[model samples]
Target: MPAEDDFTVTPYAVEGDVDYDRLLEQFGADALTDDQRAAFPDPVHPLVRREVFYAGRDVDAFLDAANAGETHSVVTGRGPSGPMHVGHVFPFYFAKYLQDRTGALVYVPVSDDEKYLLKDESVGAISDHARENLLDILAVGFDPERTRIVVDTADADVVYPLAVTFAKDVTQATVNATYGDPVNVGLSFYPAVQAAHLLLPQLVEGRHPTLVPVAVDQDPHVRVCRDVAAKRRYDVDKPGALLSKFLPSLDGPGKMSSSADAPGILLSDDREAVFEKVRTRAYSGGRSSVEAHRRRGGNPDVDVSYLLLYYFFEESDERVERLAREYREGSLLSGELKEIAAETVADFLEAHQERRASLGPLEAELPKFRLAEAERRNARRRAGFPDDSLAQQ
Candidate 1:
């Protein structure tokens, strides 16, 4: 294990204290320049404007296409190893914001197979989680015409063959070097499936700019896929990446995950539950006593409650800045700050839950968001498979 202060970030786990700048340097991705931030369509998403999504690879190409009203797409995905939480929905919501603004086509691939390979869970359990996760994703209200939700196992007819085409070019050595040695053969071959996911939109729609907005920990997957695209065998552009900081867990200073033991506010969490969790579990950066806190202001920088608000919940730049100012100046009590964050997050969740409740059955709703037969065929053909290769055995 790495030492307490020595951070380790990988697709499978993130540990220790991450230095975002150092991580960017190690990844060889460029920091988001001011010009790049200003180039996003009017009313930029908070994630980009606030520099939470602070680094990227090939961002300018995607932005240029979006600015010129050309076709572009955003690929972000989920691994249904467990229940959906507040942290899981940030990128989906961010994608929706971009789609609404720029009409970016969104591709959401649920990597159930990868989850099963990585976890010790039964296939049935992983499938169950995938079903529940798909519901939460649909609740985000991506335009069905503009979005495609792919389940790896369910869509294996298309996904597997596509993976096979790319898998030929991806060596085991590369996989081990990019990600640590895999425990299973399925895991070893997953980077190819991921490449298929990133390049699928372009494969179907023809070569065009694609942006993948993911947490920085997932950058390696994009890099691997980019290498495949760079091989120039396929008529696809190297997908751009919009890398983000990890959404802090309630206990503070780490990735908020469904797998964590900490009390994460789930998408299904009610207002009361949200309040209780934030009140009791959220890490505080304030002084020990109320008197001490009043005498010496709290540090919102490390406070989970403040982070929740600043990260996504609080939209207004002026308001979030004021909250930080008050916290630093000792006017805002820790409890008061927690309450504010809890209320804001609860309100957002309630709206999400309401939308989720209003949706019909997943079976009825998922078809429109899935790749059509023609699309599947076109993508397969682009991958160098024969036109008749898609025929069943």
Candidate 2:
């Protein structure tokens, strides 16, 4: 257990049980009020309804724009350090939901450069991961017309220049405070690149509310970008944030596993592999004996299996509630709950794998989602660069 002041949450690390409420106070983000939740489009996403997306910064402004049918965008991104797990793709799906409901533009940035700076991997290795991850992202079925996918290295002509302008506003001390001391200069400057990502939609589409949906641990990155936006160097609002709790890891309640060796249910995992991982590794809150479990009932709140269902897989509110009720009343054993969750997760992955397998070559599928020539020019120009600056060559 972490002491009250001992826990750490950062873009790259999350440790100990996170106190989401305290984090709101600490991060100066507001809890998602009932009114805010209700303001979402009819049939609010389960993530928003369940309070998985529990807190935010400047969310009301984005909601107001969304409600008014004004131009708005969502910036949710990926760092292609390795294979994406279930945790990695949840936000993208949530972003897609918002796009479908509100017609919001979605900007998905793949931060290959950041991965190269932060991980112990070569550029080629990170590029490999980026290509693999791109296929998975494309498989999400975002509208090619409304969604623009930017790979940092591949789109460096635009990404690098905007980051350079934003970098001028951030200081080394701020970076250190937000993300510890940098191991290398590339990382020292990566926050600027991140700020560019958060603000890309505005840069390309002109000033409008942009929302970044991310886990609470990633709030510091948003805050850094917010500060850069506040500098008024760019005609953009501080990108609003929709913060979420860490998804439960298979081993127990903690950050979802991203380590290659960790037992994560990957998007590409087969149905049998998904079941095997969950049945064998999912942490449960049941008692030592069946008799004891039946007598005392299991705790669904701490059970990873129950959490998996609640988080993303089981979408029906009534079904999820019934599962909880049965588990808490001793009618559903922990193993039984685990099986239910495994089935739900497996069903989701099976569909996802099917879509992924059907995709064409990356080179062919990616062009439709890449930024158009005008968008690149506008983004560069908006970031204070001349239209011809680093013009893709």
Highest TM-score against the true fold, candidate: 1
What would the per-residue lDDT of candidate 2 be over residues 260-367, giving only the tens digit for each residue? 545788888888988899999899988888898888888899999999989888889999899888888888998899889989998888888889899999999999
Candidate 2: 10-residue stretch with minimal lDDT? 1-10
- TM-score, candidate 2, is 0.97
lDDT of 1 by residue, 1-393 (tens): 224448899999898888998898788999999999999988987888999999999999999999899999999999998889988999999999989999999999999999999999999999999999999999999999999999999999889988998998899999998898999999999999999999999988999999999999999999999999989999999999999999899889679966558767899889999999999989998999889988999999999999998888999999999999999889999999999999999999999999999999989989989999889888888988888673433
Q: Whole-model Cα lDDT per candidate?
A: 0.92, 0.90
lDDT of 2: 0.90
Clashes of each: 0, 0
Poorly placed runs, candidate 1 (over 4 Å): 1-5, 390-393
CA error at residue 191 for candidate 1, angstroms: 0.3
Against the true structure, what is each candidate's TM-score? 0.98, 0.97
- Using lDDT as the measure, the top candidate is 1
